[model samples]
Target: FVSMACSSSSFPLMVSISGVRGIACRSITPELIVKYVAAFAYLQITRHQKDLPITEKPEIVLLRDSRVSGEWIERISAGVLQSMGANVLSCGIQPTPTAQLLALQRSNAVGALVITSSHNPKEWNGLKFIDSDGLFLSPESCDVLFQMVNNSAYQYPSFEQRGSFVDFADAAQIHIDTCTSLSYIDLEATKKRNFKVVLDSVNGAGGPIMKSLLETLGCKVIGLNLEPTGVFAHTPEPVPENLGQLCSAVVEHSADFGIAVDPDVDRCVLIDETGKPLGEEYTLALAVKFYLSATEKRGPICKNLSSSRVCDDIAKEYNCISYNTPVGEIHVAKKMVELNAIIGGEGNGGVMLPDVHIGRDALVAATLIVQLLSGFEGTISEYKKSLPQYQIVKLKAPIGNMVPELILADMKKKWEGKEGVTLTEGDGLRIDTSDYWVHMRKSNTEPIIRVIGEHQSEEEARKVCEQFMSEIQNWKAETSE
Candidate 1:
């Protein structure tokens, strides 16, 4: 069934909870979506209350991006939720964060089901479970959902017992209003300055929200794939290569800055005012600067190991503790809880501002960026100028022979005497040096081993990776020889 996800292969359709992905029918069918959603609803309902309220059926927040398959999944999943005696509130084409925020705001509900693959391709689709507190499902809850999915316990009730449906259009508006008002930038000033900004939303949930938020923020925004059509113009990852259009737009229009959000508006990468693709790593860093500037509160900060080291500097500068996790929003969120992080997220432009919400919100990302630039009294480039410059070189290796356990063991053994620094084991291996750090990870979503290194010079960073790869290759050679 995994072959079905490959473009060149045709295989029988099936669903297992690595979470659903790929084309709507060939990979993720309506039946699959319905069953998964129903199973999740069952799990949430049972876990929340020991005694089920007969009249007050458990309510669930249903949300989706602009993917056409989202329509199919939403309708089928809603039917399944209602069938499972759960009240359904549909928030159409909203960012994942909006749904999470709404679910927490409307705390009467059990949890939220977001129909998005996050940064996945146009053909791909997924369901991200958000807890009552507006974060990814806890491990205990996820396990329950997995059990329900596997046991085939998601059954619909009789006609009369079937749960009712209600239109929840205001959920999106409410989220938007909250974000626009929270640490919000002055739209009037942005407009008065005639700020020209280029926005590339990758035709996902970010489209509608970015357009609305930017317009309201008073920027003459030029948007690529402005419609929430889910027809992704390129890879929806918001990486540097996919951001050429945005960079070009900024330069061509002489826009003040360029913003790019992933498929769902949970992450926002940026381009400087000069059309320079600043890369996604800076999004979290920039957001931290803005957030702390807006508020004097300081505590622990959390991020994945693969995130930029700029966070380390920010945390140290602010006299706050910084913790690194493996990856995934759930992992970061967990660390935030432990560290009581004031802010947290990944290097992929997903800034988790706990004050606004625990999850990533690209709308919040946009508003903060706008407000930061407006308050700075200078351009984005000028603001970025104050930060240290480092060139990051990225390379990928196959994960087949490069087992994570083996890699971590070898790394620990090798780096034992080099330099003593903090280390953690969840994703792969990360070692902080006096001047630079290298994070080697096996991508959870992709079948590749990514080696990322950052240093003062490109040559230095690239050489470090090459040397590490050489050592790895040597180790493999010796192991086999």
Candidate 2:
């Protein structure tokens, strides 16, 4: 019912402490990057001083995806941090997770800046901040830092106190080695299968590293868009519809499967052996299946509330407990740490293994999934059929004029007492039934409300979503009058 439905042309540059994303020189400019980076550096130095060594300024790591605009953002960011008397460890183009891992490697690192717009288009670029512990800043951290930026309370040191810059080139190798070294991965079994995989990197930062990773896993790798040229061949996001080339390449080569990574390489999507594009939601589900099968000790699993319920089903198969957090990588990762979870990530093709690294690593997800396929007796399609089947339908409407609380109240009044249905809210309104579920909430990154439904069939999921859409429209019309 909300009428301000923004199209791609009208979508605002998403800005937050997590990152500031926009088309270069439009919503995001060099000056804005400088101010934001300076503010972030200010907070890192002030709040994270507990781990500071004596007689030195705090160090921050800087890296970027393969976007053309990222080069300028990285240079501007490094300059701002340097101006603030903070040392910068400049890592050239790399995955967002690589930057996080490199930050953890440095004993004196206070934080890191990753210049990327993630899955956004070529013109979009932004800065993602990572804390000393190699995790994205929590919402609470973002709130505090945004306040400082808005108030212009950031610290700027004089010329005598400027910080120095150092280049670190071993980040990609380190990330690769660490993933292959995880105890949960079965290298011998994976190698024995000698799987042939088609990899689509979308001409982003993932190209070289993903090829290296696939080869290391002993698979015959067919590369598409392998160059880190920053010129996107298709939409940068690894969604099913955008991955026609990957699916076709898999069929043409008769590869065992196809793999795709987002621009930053933090998220991964897969295509089955049948040249079918598997939904991004299945990435974590498949990972969870492999992880629980590999280890006898099933501790805890974690995911965002909006993620597919297949994760919970997989955890149950291993007699493990699964926890849900709000829809954010930080929320899921933080909860995983707090609960000592074995693995956790969002449904958008991100898989976070605390054993390998705290952040989402597409490389790690691909490794585990290969291990799973290598050990299984059937094709990826057969393996997918073995799991509980569910189809999800997702739609978004603008958050115009209506208060979210009032809308949620109306929903509760309408459905709370329905037979065999239950309602709960942590990040949004979710109604769970015996065979179907629906979740409606505001998007964290965009100015819209998303309604997602999961049912046994596509038709069923669509029906549920359409039902809600009609109700919301009716409610909006009434409120306007």
| lDDT of each residue in 168-229, candidate 1, tens digit only | 77866687688777644556665676668888888888777777778887888888877888
TM-scores of the models, in the order given: 0.90, 0.94
Model 2 poorest 10 in a row by lDDT: 1-10
lDDT tens digits, residues 1-481, model 2?
1112222455466655346677777767887787789899999988876677677678999988999888878888889999988899898988999988877878878999999989878887877889888999887788777677768888788899899999988888999898898887878888999999999999999999999988889999999998998999999988877999999999999999999999899999999988997788899999988888887767999987778888989898888999888777888888988999999998889999887778888998999999899888899988999997788888878767666668887898878788999887867788999988888877766566888888889899999999987777777788889
Count of clashes in candidate 1 = 1
